[model samples]
Target: MKKLLHFLFHSEVPDINERYRKVTSAFVVIFIIGYSIGFLQLLHLGPYLGPGLGDNVSFQPLITSLQALHSQNPSLWYALIALLCVTVSFRLLVMLAGYFLFEREEGSAYPIKWIIVFFLCNLFSTLTIPLLLFALATLFWVSGLDFNLGWQWIDHNVRLANQLVVNHVPTLINAPAPIAVLMIAIISGFFHYWFHRLGHTQRILWLLFHRPHHMTPALMQSTTMAVFTALPLFFFIILPYNLIFGACTKLFSSEPLYTEVIIFNCLILIPEIFGHHTALYQIASRNQLIRLASFISGGGVYHYMHHSSEPEHCGRSGAVNLVNIGGGPLFIWDIVFGTYCPLSAKTPRAGLSGQPELHMNPIRLTLAGLAQICNELYRNPSWREKWRIVIGSSSYTPTLSTDFAIKSNKIRQEQATPNPATIKNFTFSAPADAIASVAAKPVTGPQS
Candidate 1:
């Protein structure tokens, strides 16, 4: 038990400052990308919805809700605004906290790199999601099938989901909505824990999407770049339960689901943000929840092990690698596969830089992305190194390990030496034959 506890908490002192910059950068990047996609989607509705109501008719309720904000109660409006702001602000604070305690930079206390990372990843994923959804929606629309968007659909799904949960786990229905949500949350958290563990331990999977994510070992606010995966997993599994719980409350005279859902969702964001950011926040001191969530697999600890930099001691073992150790709330899938890496077991070897190596080659990039997706889905990454000459770089360094420092120093020393034959005088403007003539007649006395 003691050893188990130590393994869970042990972390190499992280460079929080560097991580802060990363987190901030990623946030900004994703934000821009999100808005940009939104803008493009808005453009598509230019002919149909107009500027004021771009695509509004397609999703009236969501649009109406947005439009209603102007006349809504000040408290309600503020709450919604605060909610969105919290998404960004809370995450930034997590990074900032780490920066203050553990990070160091040359001139600034806060690392600007985090800000850049935020924008970069935000742009990439945000744009990607909307475009993806739009493409899918368009495909369906063009197929002559009209999709309905309304509260009724939400209500129906919620009710159905509630029934499913109750049927499978009766204890959930008996508990208070928050308690029920908590139970679901616990299960969903563990699912994340295992998914992440597998993402690391299974090399084939790591090479694809997960590899690009690990591009920066140091924190970049873009750490939240994986939110798409994180949020959807919970939404599909736990959220419907909450929605159903809320619906049942209305039918059975129970508390509103909004309060609990909002609180739980908002709270869940903290770990989501902090877990991915550099380990700067001491929230770990009171991290019972994190420990519980991570212990199961996809939780913070499970993901953290995936983030470790030590060679041999790093990577996942398909068995017991925390992130994707199992396919359950805890780790049932991993147990089935015999790849479960328990927290108490020796730390699994960190997988190869499962991250896709970004290169300028068009074919390589496409292949890399495809490779990553396959790895993530099937857990069979066939990683191959492709060497290319870097024009201006003095040398290429393979993997950012401690040996890189030594290798860099050696490169500098090698560059310092000049060939004896190529001394400055050897390059005189006088003809090449002049050097031969001068050498032949070099015995002349210095005295005039």
Candidate 2:
């Protein structure tokens, strides 16, 4: 038991690099192509296509909601935008202040290239894809295609659950609004924990989606939103989670849950901002209250540790730690499931270990990442190993092992150099006459 406890809290120091390479030409080429196509499709093509392709049957609720918000107060839209900007700016400022004041000396320097890359990635993922999807979904709807695409399974479940709670569960309905909100929060947290954990454990999911987030060589304030994931992940995981939460809110409360949602969003943002600030200094003389909070909620430090690149800190599959410390605002689920790594644990390296220095172009990086995922899906032997664990054919054991890291480093080194036989085959050959002519011409010297 003592040995197990020690292993759980163990931390490894991370590697630091002062100089980062510039973005590659390939990355820039891909980025420009992707950005141009996305811009044209979203701006010029979308409006033209929308009217011709589809009717607004499915989007009526969304239209009605927008109309209601506008009718309630036109200025509310501007106010909401202002609030979003203020919150984001405030969190950024806080992270920068913390870094400069406390962690400047020890922390990795923030690279401007990475900052630019982060913003571009976020813009592409958050804005471009949604607009593109909207246009495409509209076209599909007009063509008599089912836009929901079997999401009714999830919707049906949510509706049934909400109905059961409202009709059969009298005690739940009578519960105070705060209590109901808390219950919803806990349920949301639980779902988020499992979703995050599965993303790490599942090989295909991690490669295609979660790997991009872990590709950053260093962490900064902007890192919180630096996720690069496929569009389907949002629809399948994020959208469903929100739908369930919304259903719960409607079933549990007589009043609108807008204020409650706003509060929860604000609370959640605090930890998220701090969690990505990898350089937040930790004091030795820890406050008892703060320690308790970290233990319960897997605070900023806990998450920072989650970004560690150490093999021992990772799980059996070697992609991420089995003791994954991800949770929503409160990390109650992690604590309950024994996945919570506390502040006392030593911090490990951030980013993917043994990964070559990556090009800073977001679009190219995203494409390359997807390619790598595809290669791993077909070629990596670890898939079978992970499957063994999944099938209960092998007993699960968690230990600090460097075997994977060592092999990864070796593979990276091998990839960096070409084979001698291949190099020999490509050796340039010159005709004797050409060599003689070139030798004869190169004998000229300076007149001076």
Candidate 3:
């Protein structure tokens, strides 16, 4: 048990615990800040009523006015504030914080700085979200007239997904929380994995959207990091189902059930952060039972395989279908289709062939920061860039050529081994204590 705990919390690498601690602290701080912001908006105070000891039925105009003053839905104000904070101030704060907390030197974590970069990129990305919502609204207005302009198509799909999650799946499974979570994990995981892979397999998708995600080989602590590039891939394909399914979930489920869904979403996002980030962490399966659970639950090292660079690691071309390639949290469809990769005790890149450079140097990084600001300022919107939806159908076959596969493999490999030397040379920041600590106490490196 002690050994197990050591691997999970410590590993051979020094400061792993410290890094996790910092991240947790950051999350706590952010959550508290968010709550404070929410509180200041005074949206929590709803219609209040007081009962008199004898005449409880008596209503007073003054009391009503006071209650109205105390209680108002600040949804619009909250949204506006979130827009300003997340889009504008968040990045600036992160940059300043990163520089303050992290070092700019070699082998140090510029996590703080990276956090800023992620937020700014994400803030810029949010601009498209409002546009997406408006486009959908306009399409809905047009579809009301029976004029088909591709808006109703998503609405139709959302309805279908709504039926699947709210009605069909519920009836099929008796258990609510566990079953709902598992089912969602499976279905949504499949969609996430496939859609994510699809974004890589198809070059057009890669060029149009995904490259931005890969553009930064690592991740930072910013809501923008979560929302920005993720929005493109998420909404571009899954928004219809997501929006409709969410509505159906709320409509069909009671408060308790809704709470379960929220909990499950949080659980999923934690692993998601781990999977998407450049940080390589693994949940080593202890025994066969645990391994079996990992394949179904997908909390194991399976996702790291998708990020693998070796020819053997991801050589199956036709297997590019997301549903078939199961990544941790249960999507039984992958197993039924024989695509599930069992949990391994080893780290993801262990024994895998190929290396890729994913990180950028200070100069390029600075340029990226500048370009992000510029694009936010003056980038033009086009019809294709606007209101784009990705649906898999008989009409559109997402093409995946062999050369494309090779190139993707190479990119993943390169991303694994960013030129830290180059990055450090151009970097003018202090070195991270985590890296310094690790360097001071050198342990045997992972058997890559």
> What are the lDDT figures for the candidates, one per model?
0.36, 0.44, 0.36
Candidate 3 weakest ten by summed lDDT: 46-55
Q: Report the lDDT tens digits of candidate 2 across residue range 1-448.
A: 9986444323222332434323432343344344322322222111101111111224343334445666787886556445545645555555555434433635434554565666566666667455655665677678888765332433443454545444543333645756655665565556567666655655445544565676665665454344434533544453444344444454455444443343334434444444555555242103343333333343544566566665443222242343434654345665465454334233355666444465555554454434543444445457554353233211121121111222233333102111333223321223332223222322122110
Q: Supply the TM-score for candidate 2.
A: 0.55
Segments in model 1 whose C-alpha atoms lie over 4 Å from true places: 1-92, 99-118, 147-172, 189-211, 227-256, 264-273, 279-303, 311-367, 371-448
Clash number for each model: 69, 3, 20
Q: State the TM-score for model 3.
A: 0.43
Model 2's lDDT to the true fold? 0.44
Model 2: per-residue Cα lDDT at residue 60:
46
When summed lDDT is taken over every stretch of 10 residues in candidate 1, the lowest stretch is 46-55
Best by TM-score: 2
How far residue 173's Cα lies from its native spot in candidate 3, in Å, is 4.8
> Which candidate number has the best lDDT?
2
Q: For residue 159, what is the lDDT in candidate 3?
A: 52
Candidate 3 structure quality by residue, lDDT tens digits, 74-152: 5533543344344234334433343334333224564444444444555556565556656766776766844333445
Clashing pairs in 2: 314-321, 315-320, 315-321
My TM-score estimates for the predictions, one after another, are 0.43, 0.55, 0.43
Against the true structure, candidate 1 has what lDDT?
0.36
